[model samples]
Target chain A: MSLKPKTLVDFSFQALKANKLRSFLTMLGIIIGVASVILMIAIGQGAQAQVMSRVKALGSNVMMVLPGALGRFGAGSEGTAQSLTLEEASAVARLPYVANVAPVVRRAALVTHGANSWTTTITGTTPSITAISSTMSTVEGRFFSPADEKSAAPVAVLGQTVWQNLYPNGSDPVGTTITIKGVPFTVIGLLQSAGASMGGNNQDDFVYVPLKTAQIRLFGITFIGLMEVQAAGQKEVTPVINEVTALLHRLHGLPPGAPNDFTVRNLSQILSTAQDISGMLTLFLAGVAAISLIVGGIGIMNIMLVSVSERTREIGIRMAIGATQRDILNQFLTESIVLSLTGSFIGIVLGVGAAVAVSAFAHFPTPVSSLSIVAAVAFAIFVGVFFGYYPARRAANLNPADALSYE
Target chain B: MSAPLISCQELTKSYPLRGMEIKALNGVDLAIEDGEMTAIMGASGSGKSTLMNVIGCMDRPTGGRYLLDGVDVMSLTKDELAHLRNRKIGFVFQRYNLLPRMSALQNVLLPLVYAGVNAGRAANRALAALEMVGLAALAGNQPNQMSGGQQQRVSIARALINDPQVILADEPTGALDTVSSAEVMTILKELHQTRGVTLVIVTHEADIAAYCERMITMRDGRITGDSIIKGKRGA
Candidate 1:
């Protein structure tokens, strides 16, 4: 006589119900494993997404040329001898693929307005710096005009942080005088807040001044620090970088075999690299979590083995009552699968809830993907079937007489 | 006229223990007709249980042929033997063997479940079987909550659920008190008398054997005597 599917299910449920605590305890391993897997993946992906967004905000189709070679560890330290200059930046700006070039000179200095004082990085660049960074905008007054750079005017634009620090009452700083390194500079405009960028640097914690003013007036400097170059479009970035590299080598009169004194880095490449690293991190974490799932599977196998031995007499009784080997096998296998699936369901709920909670309270991004949920469920089933087979087969293969007479 | 309900020829069974073979059954030939109430009487190691197991198709003989309801039992596969047991033979164990977790009704319906009866009809038949044993009132009670006699009755109900031709009882009352034992025997006798089911009881007790119409005595894995009691007390 063949047992119906519903009857089989009922039998499994009854057996599991017989030892509720044991069943739940056995399921705990799976629940923890699945939840951790989902949580780890969410965290990993969230971090990747955060870094990607921050990198993308750096600007579209842009590259930064620094005064040193790209080191094995990271971006090289600036060379003692300045390798970038305003004339070379203009030459890059003349390239067919080049859209804009901003020669920058940066230094940290004390700025004071009234009794308020703040230490912030002072950036000296042409007005094209505004055109180079799409996210940069003057929220209030005007930016440095060409006349300001030519005249070496003592004028400055306050970043959001500098403005707020100098004027704690939220008063507008535009058209006010603020001293930079004891040199008086009139505030021309207040830039919009750009939040934090990659490397945890506050993008809005700087003061902007004209390049000539910074070079001749604030700190005597002959050569620029870096060049921020924007390409004509997305497709022109690679070509622009290569042309800039060749132009720099020729303009600097370096030998063909000599390593570049200046390093050219693509913003998009950095973005993709960050994505790849975070993606690997996500995979590695998920893999570690998957190991726990396997451990949980082993836990299932252990409990199922114990259950089979404990119920040997029951197996015998069922066999004597005309239960086929297949019937016994199916019954035990179904019990384990039900157990794991139940755990997986609970894990999904807990994992998703935890991700949402973390994102809400901890201010961490944790995006739960449906694909992860589906994959988690599928893996749980596979684990159940794979681990449960041995014990179930052992149950089915028992000698009815021996099992019946087993004490 | 037709073949006996159970037939065995030169039946032999042995087990290997510690590098030596121990014979449980030694070339026994036996047969029983339909509608017979028989008891196999023997001491602890006389192989009465082994014979009962082979006759019930729960085990295979080492060297012999067994036929149940005219079907060759020795040649059947494990699944086919299970199906045969489900359709042609029912078991009543000494401990009642009622799944302790289930209610009486559920226990009684177990055989019908194996028989692939639909839930509605299976339940009806199980209730009828339980009613036959006079435990219908306790149908919803678990075995642990019932008296030994009641649990044995539930097992009898389970055995009878599929309406098999034969019921094999292995010391069905061994775990019960005298009164409970008598109550269980009364139910068995009733089923045998009213339904004409062939009943085989394996027991070491002479009193329990006396309830059967025919008693077969065994010694040393071999049957020594077979006799019909002229006036069986209950039959």
Candidate 2:
């Protein structure tokens, strides 16, 4: 019938409307499949974005030297616990690319202020801690001076989380005395809230004290936990790591071919690893969703076969009038494509709605991308053509006389 | 004087039944001139319908040569055959095979659409065809909404929309009552006289055969009789 694409599409719409329920039922599978794929992609993108923000919060030029054989999972400290003492921290600060270093000693402790008591992590470090860590900034009063650290003074800095938990009424905690494990330390400063990290830990849920006071008076531990190192620039982190590794190897007297005792994890490496993980997650989910879409395509094929069988006489009539085999193929293919494209459009709306609902109600971020939407629509068209071809060919190949005479 | 509009030399069609060959048309040799209204009359199983199908390009002859307007029918490709059918020949079925959902005007426009006529001009052409069939006022009526006679008229309009050289009808009034059949026959006669369209009708009724200028009778898949009528009944 001259194979006019638009006219065939119009005919297809009319045919689909002739059996509205069947058309809608055929579209249901595609709707669900597309919606699920879109939702999964949105979740994956949101997680990647959150991870990037969290890593950026740790500062781009910073590296943490943990005192143990820390694996990717962050829990491989079963062997002899490696320690990054203050001496080693100073040794790292002597490296060529080193800018600042802070040797930290952390332990969970119960603190009391008047009648209020709360359990939170207590950090012991030097004034360089503020310089090396991007997450910390004094909003009230001031950080304890290096003089305070040298004198082993009983001065403390309260994190915003600890202040909120202890005070709760917005009362100023500066100049107030708080006892840490029976040792009274007067609050000298307040640290700004840094929110949660990618690992979902509150960065502000801690108090800072002098390293010597924490070591000699509070916990009685001489060893520091870790060293926070900042390079002079972003490009200097790798060189600083190499220098620190060599210096530590020499200090520990490790001979050649000996495995290093500590792990140096840089922010960029972790960020890239996180992106790969999330990207794979998105791909896996999309693959699973595509399987369902294939199944949906099969559903369309089955119904199209049935439609062709039911309309055998109609096909014969069209052939008798003037329609060529290609014309018949185009007509049925157009019908199937119209079905899937319409289903995909509706599915997009439903998918976006579902994603937004999840984000709002569950407080999880979901980012909807235009690329995914466009991909979904293109996939739907492919499914229609891939699955619709066989049935359409069958219809077009029918003998006109037999079809016309068919009951 | 010139080549006939339709010519067949020893045309044959066969079907396989239980590993045995059943010949629907053993051999058919006939010539139909342009502007002639002819009727092929035979009882059931006489292959009259088979000849109509072959002539309408709805089926191909198994063996022999068929020429429609000097063009070799057997040599045309499927798409070319479809184009020939769209441009040179039209058919009217017994059951008035109008698409059940479409209105009469849309049914008439079907051929024009298949012929690649422009959209704006198709409606006017279809309306003219409907007027020719005296169904112009019923242009918006669907097939099911109209009576059997009106549906057949709509189909006739559809066949006429392309203004083909030949119009083929297979027991065109078989499903209609007496009055409706007479009305349909009158329209066919008027079309043949005024438009000079070559008409080929397949029928078993002698009364229906009496309306045409020539009568060709078939029996046992071969022509039994061919005669020119001195006085056609309808005109």
Per-residue CA lDDT of candidate 2, range B1-235, in tens? Answer: 7999999999999999999998989899999988899999999999999999899888899999999999999999988888888888888999988887888998889877887888889999999999988888999999989999999988888888888999999999999999999999999999999999999999988889899999999998999999988444333
**TM-scores, one per candidate:** 0.85, 0.84
List, residue by residue over A124-179, the lDDT tens digit for candidate 1. Answer: 99999888787779999989899999999999998899999999999988889999
lDDT of 1 by residue, B23-61 (tens): 999988898889989999999999999998898888889
Docking class of 2: medium
DockQ of each: 0.65, 0.54
Model 1 misplacement above 4 A? A66-85, A105-124, A134-145, A152-196, A201-209, A212-225, A232-264, B18-20, B231-235
* Candidate achieving the largest DockQ: 1
* DockQ for candidate 1: 0.65
lDDT of 2 by residue, A192-262 (tens): 88887676788889999989888888988777788789999998988988888788878777797787778
Cα TM-score of candidate 1? 0.85
Q: Model 2, A364: alpha-carbon shift in Å? A: 4.7
Model 2 regions lying over 4 Å from their true place = A67-84, A95-97, A105-124, A130-197, A200-210, A213-223, A232-239, A246-261, A353-365, B18-20, B231-235
Candidates' lDDT values, in order? 0.90, 0.89
lDDT of 2 at B193: 94
